[model samples]
Target: MGYVKTTFLMAAMTALFMGLGYLMGGAGGAVIALVMAGAMNLFTWWNSDKMVLKMHNAQALAAGDRFGLVDMVAQLARNAQLPMPAVYIIDTPQPNAFATGRNPQNAAVAVTTGLMRSLTREELAGVVAHELAHIKNHDTAIMTVTATFAGAISMLANFALFFGGSRERLGLIGTLAMMILAPMAAALVQMAISRTREYAADKAGAQICGHPMWLASALQKIQHGAAQIDNDAAERHPATAHMFIINPLHAHSRDKLFSTHPATANRIAALQALAGTMQPNAPRMRQTDMGPSTTSVPKVRKGGKRGPWV
Candidate 1:
């Protein structure tokens, strides 16, 4: 059902993009706009991971690190039946993470330093699994296409002001209205698709980790920590906020009508509901299987605060 909803929303976005183009000009103009959008999105899909990492000043986590994050991610990747994605750590105090790549094979997962300090080993696995789910689902590709469509629609809407042909088609008043409503409608659709994908990822991630409660607990802690810490990088590049597991641009406020990510509370409630259905003897990934050192002893991070994550 979730996938069905996502497909329907994606189709709606495409229709809206083409319809906006038709309004801007004619059938020929629609084709041109779609072609232009596709060309633009190709670049986005190819380099989005590198671009996002650079923006956040993310440093690659080398293998055999003392913190065991690299090894832990590798174990989780195997559990997810995915290739081990490149791992990175950002310097921010915000406990947030995001995954980027066109597909699972090319994916990279980046987490903030604060995340390492905030989550237990099990909670970290949950977060890693969530990110893996995004990679497996090709969320980066979907979001890039949707973003391109939204941008192209907005561009066409604004271009209507200068293009005399558009005025002839929609009339003066009609063109003005299109300029306003087209972008709004496109934005709404984009938000819908993003929200839907988040839900799908949450469920799939829980399954990959074999513990829905672990993710639920991680979400709460991350939500609390994120609200207290401002992600300066995310604030600067507001456009990329949707990529994170949580909305990093704002505090843990109530879910808004057009928020990029689903509300943490709602997501937790769903996970809790899922936990209710799992069998008592189901196979579960033990936290010890991740790395040599357990979450019991808080490994002091060099050049950072020396304390175990709660």
Candidate 2:
């Protein structure tokens, strides 16, 4: 189902690119746009993972250096029957994580520093497991490909604006209308695809962790933290915001129409409902309006400071 949606969205994005080209340079402009879009798609397929990681300035962590983090991820991968993937850390205050690569064999998982400090070991496992689920289910490949196409669509719109479009049949009015509407339409289609993939990842991640509550808790923490802190990298490169587990952008006041992720409240409710089905008597914390419940997990402290490994 994800693959199908990505395919449809990519097709729409590609068509949008072609439309922008036609408005800019008639048949000749479209020919150039197609060639450029095709070339970009090929390049992105091979290097998109690296591109995404680099965009966030993520650094690879050696197994020895990240023993605890690696071990947790390894255990979860074992549970999911997936091959071990490289682990990385992004030096950012935002509590977020993301998985990338074309396939599990070449995949990498990245977590922010704030996530390490904020979540418990069990909650971290739940989060890592969710990212692994994305790799295992091949969501990484789908999203990377979708992003490449969607990016090209927007690029084409920009190209149209810069090159003054084709001097074809469309007079002043049509040209003006196309320039104003094309990119917005492309963004809408791309956001729709992003929303669907996120929901699918949430469900798959919950299954991988075998504990929907853990991920629900992690999501609550990440969302609240993300809302407060700014991920400068994400805001500067909005194109990559969808790659993060949560929308890393700090533009929180925007309505759903302009936002990338689903409402945190809705996501938590869905997870709670999933938990209910598994164990009718499962322990649940009493959740407040938008925060985690009153129940708290004990913090592990080291050197008089709470640490992530705890």
| Global lDDT of each candidate | 0.83, 0.75
- TM per model? 0.91, 0.85
Model 2 Cα lDDT, one tens digit per residue, 236-269 = 8988887788888864633377676777777778
The candidate 2 region of ten consecutive residues with least summed lDDT is 285-294
Could you give candidate 1's per-residue lDDT for residues 1-310 as a string of tens digits? 7668878887887787777777666898789877887888898888888988999999998898767888878877888889999999998889999999888889899998888888878888889899999988888778877877788788888988778777888889988998998888888888778888998899888988889998999999889988878999999987788889998977436667678888899999999998999777644677576643345436777787654532
Best by TM-score: 1
Q: Tell me the lDDT of candidate 2.
A: 0.75
- Poorest 10 consecutive residues of model 1 by lDDT? 289-298
Per-residue lDDT of 303 in model 1: 89
Clash pairs, candidate 1, are: none
